[model samples]
Each structure stands twice: as structure tokens, then as C-alpha cells.
Target chain A: MIGKLNRNSTLLSSIISIILGMLVGAIAMLLSGYDPISAYGALFSSVFGSASDMGETLRTITPLIFAGLAVALAFRTGMFNIGVEGQLVIGSLAAAFVGLKLELPPVLHAIVALVVGALAGAIWALIPGLLKAIRGVHEVIVCIMMNWIALFLSNYMVGKVLSNNSDSTEKIHPSASIRVDFLTDMFDGARVHLGLILAILTTIFVYVLLFRTKLGYELRAVGLNPDASEYAGMSVKRNIILSMMISGGIAGLAGAVELLGTSEYLAINPSLPGTGFDGIAVALLGANTPIGVVLSSMLFGGLFNGGSNMQYVAEVPFEVIRIVFAAIILFVAANFVKQLGNRKNRKKKGEKASA
Target chain B: MLSTMTNLLETTILYSTPLILAALGGLFSERSGVINIGLEGLMTIGAFTSAVVAINTGSPWIGLLAGIVAGILLALIHAVATVTFNADQTVSGVAINFLAAGLAVYLVKALYDGAGQTPVVESKFTDLAIPVLKDIPLIGDPLFNTSPITYIALILVFVSYFVLYRTPFGMRLRAVGEHPHATETAGVSVVKMRYVAVLISGALAAIGGATLSTSIGSEFSATTVAGQGFIAIAALIFGKWKPFGVLGAAAFFGFSVALSLTGQVWGLTEYVPSEILTMLPYVLTILALAGFVGRANAPAAIGKLYERGSR
Candidate 1:
């Protein structure tokens, strides 16, 4: 069927684009007065160098997978959720606030903190979603504005609201931490925690929610053709809002996972975390699929983990990896361009045949 | 009291020039049926190029030219991806932002052996005071004693208005944005018009970037341009895509930034955090979009790729 063929091509295109991305990175390094092969070699060796290094890579990938799924879910529903950065910030702040302040049993403490964080993200996303559904406002503009607001507000909270007269808060209680003793021992005292296991489980949950549920079917239907979906007795507006809330909640959960699993305290960020923005690249390279997002995120995790080693051994900047990610998106979107041309040509041929 | 008012006026003008130039550039591209969210990246390219050239050549003029060229080159890549290949404009724009940030920092480390800064330039664009005009009561000193780009930015608004409404090229460009099929039927190539528009945007945006390095007392750093490009987009929408309207919007946003910077001297920072003060422009922008502008009509085919004989 045409649908199956299209899906295969999309998957094929994602793989090809990633290779192109690496090639582009290599060429960029060569031009910048560095040896491409050695830079990449140092990069891989550092990623796989030791158990602690691998644990660090997994820690980084854990947040990325959650954020990537957040973006991919929105992409499948035809909404561009550019506010993931803002959502994640609020989510983390909420988690940190509750984890440090609340008193409860150990497991209950962690659960409450994560739920509150996800709820905060959902509430933040709810504003733009509601505006888009009810008032016909563009979500992109609203989200961009909200991003700055969140950045400022969170910075304020960390500095003034929750601070014990310092810029950063005290660490959260041990009861709320997600670190697992066995995992840390296995990785030789690495900061690897239960967050990785949670991330994998969330990935499976998202996959099922997207492809194996009636709500998922309706959400896709609305995305493909809102008018048809509306005629078929679906509430297009409700689905839009629901999809955005779910997307935001996942991004919020990413914030909780990262905070409880690793740092255990929120520091005053000089800028918004790059994890949310990087998620867009991960989603695009994965072709917006659950399994694909995990695999692609692992590759990205390795690259970032190895970036410092590349810098240390080969004198190549870590920015070279950022450039490579940008290149991959460019090549992947290039397929959309080619498809546009083909669609027009086919339409022309069809008209001619009818005449 | 009069001195404070004049000082505020001067800062507002200084803050608004880059924004005005960038918004005007966005006006041209969006009017021609292409949504260029990469104006920020183009401005970054412009800022970095100008600063480096000015530092080496010791001439701000030559640096300005190099900055413009850098912006054009980046815009060309965007055009190839979006206009030729029919890529998603927003995604392409985001890519450009990443590419510009990474490449600029990478080159800075390579060339300067620093984290992400260029060497300070010896020559900067100096402010010029008009002889008689600068002495006129309250507005004179602030309005007349500004750099060359300030005057040029104001002139560009009128010039864009003239070209967009009076010239044949402008008509075709607008026509393409509203209805590409009509423009194609009338023998204008929609693709060519869009390419030209996007390139013009790049040139103007680069000049905006140049102002940051050459006029503002700051060296080129990773955060030099900040989010000015996005602010320019906000201005474009606030102005409802009109050249004069964009000028007004840019000035208003610029006023907010000026207030934030000078709030400490003005004693307003005591009541508000600088972070919150810095967020005023963005907050106002959101309010402006949510029904304050009444009705905003973007070019119908703004984000769509043109195809022959297709609706």
C-alpha cells in the first residue's frame, strides 16, 4: 500500500540523513583545521572508555529520551510544541521545590514530587493550548513568549523564593532521591540512577499510547484532517488540548528525572538547559517514533559524552557535534522539499491524463 | 528632570536602531511569501563577521560590508533549503540558529584561543551630533546625536514603504504572498521573487547585527545578539507587517529594553528584579498578539512552497 511505502521511506530517510549528518561533521572538522578521523575516534573511545563514562552517557540520554518523546508525540498530532524548554524548566522547579520541602515516606516523596512537576508542566502548556483551540491564536508565538517568562520566573524562584538566602537551594532529602545503590555500585560510583529505568518504561508507555489506543487513532485522525475528524464525531479542539498537555507532562517528567536522579539540587542556570532544544533534533532524526527516539537519543548521548574527550585529544571543539545535529535536520527536512516537487508533478500528470 | 528625559530618549534611540533594521528586513521577506525565522542567525553571522573584520582592518565601514556579506551567505543557504528544496521554514530556521551558534563559537575558539569572544575592535562607529538640530530643547540632543545607522534605519522604513507599495517588484512580491498562482499566471516566477526577498532580509538583518558590534560598546560574544531577531519578528507582527507600523513597534520594544537597562539609575530596579525587567518586551509582545492588534493577516502562502499549476 502507498501508506506502508511512505512509512518505509520515512524510516529509510532518517537513517540516510544521520549518515549524512556524520559526513557533514567530518568535513566541517577538516575545514576547521582538525583531523576528522582522529576527532571522531577520540569521541567514540571516550564514550566507550569505561563503565563510569558509559553511566554518564546513559544519564544524559535519560532526559533526552523523555524530551524526545515529548516532541515526537506532538509532531504525530500535528502540533509544534516549541515550548518544551519552558515546560521542562517549570517541571524541574516544581520537583525540586516539593522534594526539598515535603515530608513523606521515601517512595511516596519521590512519586509526589514527580507528579507535581508533571502537573506544573501540563498547566504551563495548557495556556497556549487553550488559546490555540478557543481563540485561533498561533501556538508558536505564544510558546516563544512563555519560554522567556518561564526562564525569568524560574530564575527568580531559585534566587529569591526557594533560596536559603543563596542563589541555589539546599539538596533534596535522601527520601526523594532516585539514585539506586546497586546501579551506582555497578558503575563504580557513577551517578547512574533509577531514572534510566523510568525513562525506558516511559518510552514503552508513550509507544503504546500513540499506536495502540483508540485515543491515539482519533488524535492522528485530527492531525491528518481536522475537518474529517470533526465530521466523524470527534472533538478536534479537545484533542488538540489533550495532546499538548500529554506532551508537556512528558517533558515535565524529564525535568523531574534529571533533577532527582543526578544533581538532587537545582542550580542557577546561566541559560536554559540545551536538553529541550536538542530533543527537537532527536525527534526529527528518529522520524518521530518511540523506539527510533531511544536509539537516536543513545547516539546523541554518546556524542555529547565524548565531546569533551574529542576536545581534549584532538583539539576539536564540542560545537562540532552541535553543527552535526543541525546538518541532520537539514538533510531530513530536504526530503519534504523533494516530496513537494513530486506531488506537484504528479498532480500535473493526472490533470493531463483526464483531459 | 529634563536631563533624565533626554537621557532616556537617547537610550531608546540607541536600543531601537538594530531592532528597526531587523524588523524592516523581516518585513521584506515575509511580504514576499517566505517566513524567515532565521533572522536571528543571520544577525549573529553579521555581528561576528563585522567584529572580526573591524578588529583586523581597523575600519568599521569595511567590517560592516563583511557583516552584510556573511548574512547574505547564510541567507542563501536558508533559501536553498526552504525555497528550492521546499523544506519546512520553521525547522530550517531553527537549524540555521543552531548552525550559526555552533560555527561562531567554534571559529572563535580556533581563531582567538578564547572561549567565545572576538578581539576588541579599535574603530567603532562614532555618534555624530547635528550642528543646530542637537540644541533644540528636549528631543534635539537625543534625536540628532546618534550614529549613522540610526538615520539609515529610519530612512529604510520610508524606503521600504515606497518600494512595497509603489514599485512593480513590490506589487509582484505582495501578489506572490497573497496568491502565488496569480503571480505565476502573470509571468512572475514565485521562486525568484521569494529568493530575492529572503536575501534582502539577510542584508538588512546583517546591518542590524553590525550595529551591535560597531556602535554598541560591546565586543562580539556568543550572546551578543541575544534574542533580538525574535523580538524583531514580534515587532513585525505587532506592526501588522507594515513598514511604518514595524518602525513604531520596534521603537516601543526598544523603549522597554532601554527602561530595563537604565532602571537602576532611574531607581526602578529596587522594586523589580532585572530578570523580570528584561522580560517586559516579551510579555508585552504576548499581550499584543492576543487580540490587542485586532486582526493580523499574514501572507496567505507565507509558509507554503510554490508549485506550478497547483492550488
Candidate 2:
């Protein structure tokens, strides 16, 4: 049944599925005695209501863009980097520590802090990658365990060492703070900074690197079939490590943007942050494409920003958004399974015909 | 010194119970070829359901049963997804986790009028003291005087070990996981074995949750299980997926947790932030997984779809 569906038609079907999912969500809201229209209206208004609201949405989207890209990149390489949450936390802490201690010009300080953050994330991700590559450890198990370590370690460091007797880290030095007075002025006191531009550039970079480069081809080939890639003379082990490092670096940059652009300080209890895990769902929904990740990030950001208002207006709990997200994941996963089934059936038919 | 030692031993046993139960649950699923990543979520559901039911019915026994049933139901979702739909086991497991969490929270709010918790219950599991055994010095109270669930869990460990190694059923379960087609060709029903194993996994995990609510906290909280499910998974791997090995790994993690909390009480490491000590289990998990156990082997068909028409 699915083999008959063209690529364009499948894409259309997926879009229709999303729309149908939203409708189902609306029905759920209505069944629960909430005004679905008003709730959705509040959601859209909250995200695009005013210049300030738009800025907040953009600020939120900035880090999501990087994190989503990070997760998507790893997914393309057939690695499930569940440690992105941990990587992001450690990266943020690393950048915040560097940002607070550094005394350089604003651009240089910011750049240095971001680089430190990315490096930290890369190093953090490398542990699991190395375990997978050399020791034959499953990345999922290692990454999940590493996330806990990162969370606890970062919490301890922020609480005991960098906290200055407070719950949060010392504020980043003036030089390290990425000021976006230009955009702020344009938006009349909005927090949207140059990080958005950087995020977009990073997305484009990821796109080109993944699709346009020989290295990207090799990485994708390794992801598709490690044995085949090895047969074709691709170094699967090196590609695996390189892909993970790049994945972690992107996620780490996300942490830097969140700290420097929005949070401006580090909190001791940076549990999960939701962005890293949410990135998994985002990447899945986006089909692990750069453009797909951006659009999916926007959808997720909107849901988060809107869910708050939905709670305010409908008196429904904000956790409804989590349900919605989970539902989408379930549907997408089911779709993937169905697609796999179709492919298997097609293969069998081809074999029979040849025989 | 005797009192401190007894306290430490008691704490270790207490912490190890849940880990052992959950890991034993995971053992069933993974050994049967299904990657039970939803173990955590199933445990959560079990914990919440058992707590709520126990509070309502004023029967710890009934609550325990309900917890097991709740866990089985959730595990069934995972079974259907991976077994029938052939969905990605990890993704489906994650989806189950998120869904269970959201559904549980939503139900709590809806039923409790947004209190985010159920009211405290009067009924809970009381520890069983072996009549003469409880009179022994030091080790007696900590070891002999405990909840019935502890003894049940210990018995389960032995039973599971025997089941996994001694029985024809055990042989078939392992065979299906290692080679489903071969098992099927040998006239064993692979699907039936997988279904049973996963269901058993769910029930055990749920019982673990029930133990937490009825024996430890006497109330259900969102963070009650708090990644204990993942700890069980680590314990399973750390123990090389063997039943007794998993039990030992669970005890090891339990010791770390017990030590951390005990350190706070004894003022041994009071100056150090308790969070660092709390993180010891996960840190240890990563380290153990990184190299200590050498190469961990998963079932050959462990997350792969077993389609009759395909392979």
C-alpha cells in the first residue's frame, strides 16, 4: 500500500497527519471542558502577540535550533545521542564559568565562551562515543548514564563552587555577555539577540556539511550500513566518533546561546532542561533534516509558549503539552514502522519476481 | 559501631529491593528479545497506581496487585508497539515514558483538584519479624526483620535464576532471544514466549514501584521512582544481564545510595554537597558500563522485529 505512494504524496500525507493530530488535540481539549479555539488562539497570540512576545519566542527558538540540529545530525548518523541533555548542561556550565572569569572584548569573550561550551559538550559526548566504538557499548545506555552524571556534577559545581553562596552562578562578565542592543532597540526592549542569526547560520552550515560534503556522504553511508561502509573503505569507527563530536558541539553551542542570550547566569539544578530531549522528538518529526528541524523547533516552541497561556485560560494543566508532544511522537513512530513494513514487503515481492 | 553497621546494612537492603525487582523485570524482557526501555515508565505507573489504590482501599495487598496489573498494562503497550507494529523499541519506550508521565500527572490533577498529589494514606506495609530470628544481634533485625516484599524479592531472584537456566521454558526463552527463527523452527512459539516474558517483566517492575510507595514513602509523588528504573537497567547491564549478577549490581547501587544518605546523617561528609554523593550511582553506572564488566552482550534479536514473512 505504501509502496504506491510517491515521495511527494508521502510528504503531503505526513503534513495531513500533523493537521489531523492538532484536530485530535483540539477535540481532547473540548472533551475536557476547555475552549479549544480560545486556547489555540491564546497560544498563537502569546508567541506572536507583541514585539516582546516575538522576541521571547525567538530567544527560545535560538537554543532549540542548535539542540535540534545536534540531535538531528546524530540521528542521521544512526546514533541516538540521549546524552544531549547532559551535554547541554555541562556545556552551559562550562561557558558560564569561562564567561564569568574572562576579561576580553565582547565579541572575543563571547566566541571563546561558546567554543569552550562546544568543546565541553564534544568531550562529554566523546566518552559515550568511544565506549561504543572501542568497547562495543550501546550508546543509548552509556548516554543515559552519562546524562545523570553530568546533571549531578553540574549541580554540585554550581551549588558548591561557582555559586558565590547563591543558587546561581556569578553573572557573566560584561565582555562575555552577548548584547543585542541593536535588535532590542528595533523590537522595543525585546531579548532576541544576534544568537538567532548565528543559529540560522549554524543550521545552514549543518545542511551543507551533511549533504554537500564527501565527509557527510561517508558519515551517512556509515549510518545506513556500518558493514557496507566498511566494505566500501569508509572508516566507520572514525566517522562514528567524528559525528558524535559534531553532534555534541552543536548541542553545546545551544547551551552557550541559552546562557549568554537568555538566562545570563547558570542555575545549579539544570535538570534535563527539556530542550535536549525535546530535540529528539523535533528531529524525528523533522525527518532529521535541517529545514525540518527548524520548522519542528518552531512548532515545539510555540506549543511550549502557548501551553502556558492555555493553562491560564482553560485552567488545564500545562502538562497537556507534554501529552501532545508524546502523542505526536507515537504517531510519527507508528508511521516509521509502517514505512519499514512496506519496504520489507516490496523487497519480498522483488525477490519473488526475480526468482 | 554495631548500631552503625546494622543501620548501613538495613539501608542497603532497603535500597536494593526496588532495584532488584525492577532489574529482574528488565531481565525478563531483554532475555526474551524485547528491549524493555519502558521499564521505568511501567514502574512509575505501578508506583502511582498502587499508591492511589492502596490509599483508597486501605489494603496494601490490593495495592500491590493493582501496581502489578498497572505495570503489565503499560508493558502491553510496549509489547504491541514493538512486537506487533515493529516500531523502534527505544523511541516507543520513550513515548511510553512521556505518555505515562503526562497521563499520570493529568489524572492526578483532574482527580485531586490540582493538588498534584493524593492525600496521605493510613495503610502501609508493616515489616515482618521472624519470631526467634529477630532476637539475634546486629545482623538479625536488619536482615530478618523486614517487609514481606523483601523476602519475596529475594525468592524471586532465585526463582528467576532457576527459570532462566534450569527449565525447558528458560531454554526456549533464551533461544528465541538469541535466534527466533531457529527457536520457531524448533517448534517453540516465539511470540508467546516474548509476550509472557514482557508481561512478567512489567509485573515485577510494578511490584518494585509498589514496594516504594507502601514500604518506603507511604505516598505517591511524581519523583518517587526518580530514574530508579534507569538504575535497574544499568544494574542489568552491569551484572552482565544475568539474574544473580543483576541482583549484585542492584545491591552495589543500593549501597552507594545508602552510603550517601547515611553520610549525611552521620556527618561523615556533611561539608560536601549531598548532590555529589547522590550522583555516585549514576557515575558508577557510567564507569561500570564504560569498561569494568568488559563486553556486555545483548540478545541477537533484542530490538529487531520478528516478522515471520521477513527472516
Candidate 3:
């Protein structure tokens, strides 16, 4: 029982540990001849400095929000959808194809592109989900493999089948591009676009769906304990597949937004954007909640944008951000373990005392 | 058609070396209930270390040892996190990946004097032709004449299979993965077994990375491994995590890459986009995992955090 309390205290200690970690990092920076305060000031100011910086930060957060939501949703249902990267890639390709080929009013075209992208993502994700539900293959292995396939397939399509005048897809028609003029005017020329609004709406939708709907309940129940849910007469298999598909669709939307709103076309060597993998960190930090994912995504976005600027101005390597991210993950994962251990210990103690 | 076959065989040997080694590494860790998702990162570290060492020492063999040592040290970190501290296996694995990547790039810039890549080593592993075997019509040149790593990879496959299925240590490792409590009752130390498994995983993965630098490229770049470690994981699952099965899957993937590269040489690109051909291996891997490989049952307690006094 004493051991349990100590374990629980570890969670509290983790918080203290994180602060200590920052101090350690600060000391190291000082020893390295860097002004920690100035570096941090630059990081924050570059992220929230001018309106333009803020706009770029928001722009970076847009896809992260969608990817984070995708990961979080699957996580909530006890599924590890590592294939979000693949889903995002395929989704973006689908959106870019539609944006370039389709002719419609601006609003309708954007909607169509986004929908197509989501549907493409859902379809790609559904394969692994169905396999897990019906055949008992683990989603982790399946998702990771699918991500690679999606990457190669998208790269191939953009470089070959969908190639326009260049080694990339044709630029989307004016009607298909998301209007960033408002953001441009607001920031005196920033790249933020309507994707941010869509991301927010999706967050609210995810929150409501997870907390308010019967489907959400079933999904969560299945995630918590599949056998228990089955004993309670829920179709665990169907729910698992559904959760994966929905998550995939959300990830797909992230890709679509990136292509249509940000890049305006698909480049053959489109930088992986890292949105899918970053979503993993975001989801974990957010505790897999809608609001949590949104906030976490923003924080990550800030770090990314700030890190880039730090590279440019402070001569700090952008890789430092990765180390920071890893440290945070280590800190949080350790805290979670401590909390679980403490809870289990406390439960045991309470039972023994009552008996 | 004959030339195509020879090219395919050569490509298969080239592609399979890393996959086979990495999958063997994963087999060691996962069969003992520790999921080593850091295989990719470990491979990257190994590749970077070997590249640098070879450049300095002018000996690919020394570089190989360096790679393995680096891998073992990194694996020790994972062992501490998952085995000693009982951290979440998946997240810790992911953190290791990030740390390895960040550290490698940072060190490369710092140690290599701001070059994002290592100096190309003159002492690369050379392809060896088995005298008589090399004379065999089509099969000899492609399969028999290869870098030493190919021979090591092939031998390791059987060795791994024997270790996992036919050895006492293998039984204990399997026992721990399947039922730690029962294994403990039987007088086995679960933590010790897991630590060993994870370290072996690291060593094997690093060998794969070293092979890449010494045999294939002779230098290390940021994206050197390029998610091949994850691909090995996929191959492992698709092969049902068996040594021979993984070999087959790796070879299958190798064939795809080989075919794609060969397609360019064969002028097949005039009809089909080379990019489409390049997508074949990844596409096939997904398909295999989704259904082609059938159902794969992971070890019980695969990712659970084991507590000493829980029971």
C-alpha cells in the first residue's frame, strides 16, 4: 500500500521533473554559450510575434488539428492507426486530382475536393480496420505498412500518371483554391486559409460525436474492453472497423486541406509534411481528446514554426525541437505509467482495508 | 527475359539483406514481448556510425563492429525504459526513434564539420564470388556473387529460427512473452529475458544498417534507412513473425524493388510509369498485412506494462 502511494507521487514528481528538465536544458544552453532567455524569447516572439508569424503558426496548425483528431479518435477507440500518414497522402492526392480536373464554383469545388479526399482516406484506412475486425490482424502493423504503400502510390501518381507540365500535378483552378485573402489582408500577407475554420468545425464535430452519440459510446466501450463490450451485446468487430474508417477519413481531410489550401497542387516530392507522425505526439499530449488535440496541435505548430525561425536567426539547429519533443513524450509517458501504478495500488489497498 | 531474371535475382539479394536483418532483430525483441519499433532509428544510428567509422578506420569490418556496438547501447536505453522503468512500450519505442534521428543528425553536423552526410568511405564491403558457384548459369552470378552481409543474413535466418524454436533460452523467452507470471513461477526472470531480447534486437538492426552503408551506399545521409525498419516490421507480421517466413516476405519485397529497378533498364517504362513499378513493394506489403498473410496472432501481453508485485 505504501508502495502504491509512492507510485502515485511519481505522477506529481513527473510535473516537477519536466520543470527540472527545462532547467537542465537551459543550463546546457548556457554552457554552450547560448542565451536561454533570448532563445526562448525569439521562439515565442517568432510564433506570436507579428500578425504574420501568428498567421503562419495558425496555418501550420490547421493540418495538425485534423491529423491529431484522426489519431486521437482511433486512440479513444483503442486502435493504433499509424497509417494516418498513408491516409493523408492518398487523401491529398485525391483532393489534388479533383481540384485540378474538376470545374465548379469555388465553394462547391472545395467541398467536393475535401469530400473526395476524406472518402479516399476512409477507403484506404478501411482495409486495415476490416482486417483487424474480421481476421484478427493487429492494426499497428497493418497501418504502418499501409502508410508506406500510400506514400509510394501517391509519389508515383504525382510523378507519373498525374504529371502536368512539371513533375507534379497541375495547379488547382482558382475556384478550387481556398481563399486566403482574408488572412493575407489581416496579416499584410500571410498564408493562413479557410482550412483553420474547417479544422475547428471538425474538432467540435469530433467532440460531440465521441461524447454524445450512441456510436461513440459503443466505440469507447469496445476500446476499453472488447470482450466486455461483446458480452454486453455490442458488435465489437463493426465498431472497430467504423472507428478506424472514421479516423482515416479525418486524416484524409488533413491531406486535402494541405493540398488545396496550402500547396495548391501536389508536388512529386511533396515534403512528408510530418503532420501524420506529429499527430501522434499531439494526440498523446492531448490525452486523446478533441480539445486536447486542438490545443496540443497549436502548441506543436508553434514549436515547428518557432524552431524554423530559431534555425534561421539563432543558429540553433531545428533538430533541437525534436529533442524537446522526445523529452516531453518521455516525461508524459512516464507520468502516465506512474498514475496507473498508483491507481492499481490504491485500489488494492482499499480492498484490503475494507476486507 | 533471361536477362530480366538475372537482374531480378540480383535486386532481390540487394534488397533482402537489410530487411532480413531487421526482421530478425524484431523477432528477438517481440518474441520476448517487447515491441521494438525503434528498429528504423537503430538502423539509422548504425548506418551513421558505420559510415563514420569506416571513413576513419578504412575498415568496413571495424565499422560493422562500431555499428553493432552503437545499436546495443541504444537498445540498452530502450531496455531501461521498457524493462526497468516499465514505460509504455510503444511510446518509448517512438521516443527512441525520435531521439536517435535527432541525435544522429545533430552529431553528424557537429562531428562532420557541418556536413549533413558522412565522408564516403573507400573501404566498402566488396561482393565475393563463390568460385565454382559463381559459374552456375544464371543463379550463380546474382546470388553467389554478393557482399559478405548477404551470406551473414542468410545464415542468421536459420540461426534465428533455431534460437527461437529449438533452444532452451528460446523457450524461456517465449514463455515470458506468453505468460510472465507463469514463467516467473517456473523460475525465470522475465525482466532479464526481455532485456536480452531487446538488446539483441538492437544489435541485429544495427547490423542491417551497417550493411546498408558498407555494402550498398558507402555513406550515410539523413534518410538513409528511409523507413526500412518499419517495412521489416511489416514483413515480420506478414511472415507471421517466423524466421523463415520473414525471409520469404523480405525476399518478396526485394523482388518488387528489384523488378522496379530492372523495369527501368528493360525499357518497360515506355509503357508503364517507373513510379508505379516502385510502388509495388509497399503496395504488396499492405495487401499482405491486410489479408494475404492471413491472421497473425501477436504474443500475449505484447505491450502490457509488467509489474513485479501485481499478482
TM-score of chain B of each: 0.96, 0.95, 0.95
Q: Kindly give the stretch of ten consecutive residues in candidate 2 chain A with the minimal lDDT sum.
A: A4-13
Would you list the clashing residue pairs of candidate 2?
none
lDDT of 1 by residue, A1-355 (tens): 9999988778777777778888989998888788999999999998978988888888878998988998888878778787888898888999999988888899999999999989988888887888789876777777777777887788888888888547788899999989989999888787989989988998999889988999988888888899999999999899989988998999888888888888999877656686777888788878789998998899888888898779998888888888888888788876743466587999999999999
* Whole-structure CA lDDT of model 2: 0.83
**Candidate 1, DockQ to 2 decimals?**
0.64
Q: Candidates' interface RMSDs, in order?
A: 1.8, 2.2, 2.6
TM-score for each prediction? 0.94, 0.92, 0.91
What lDDT score is found at residue A122 in candidate 2? 94
**Tens digit of per-residue lDDT, candidate 3, span A153-226:** 78877776677436777788888888568777897577888999999999999999999999999989998999
Residue A245, candidate 2: C-alpha displacement in angstroms: 0.2
Using TM-score, rank the candidates from best to worst.
Answer: 1, 2, 3
Per-residue alpha-carbon lDDT of candidate 2 for residues A144-190, written as tens digits (9 for 90 to 100): 88888887888777877787657878788878877678899876687
Which docking category, incorrect, acceptable, medium or high, applies to candidate 3?
Answer: medium
Top candidate by DockQ: 1
- Give the better candidate number (2 or 3) by DockQ: 2
- Provide the TM-score of chain A alone for each candidate, in the order shown: 0.92, 0.90, 0.88
**Candidate 2, superposed: residue stretches over 4 Å from native:** A1-6, A16-41, A164-166, A182-191, A336-355, B270-276
The TM-score of chain B in candidate 2 is 0.95
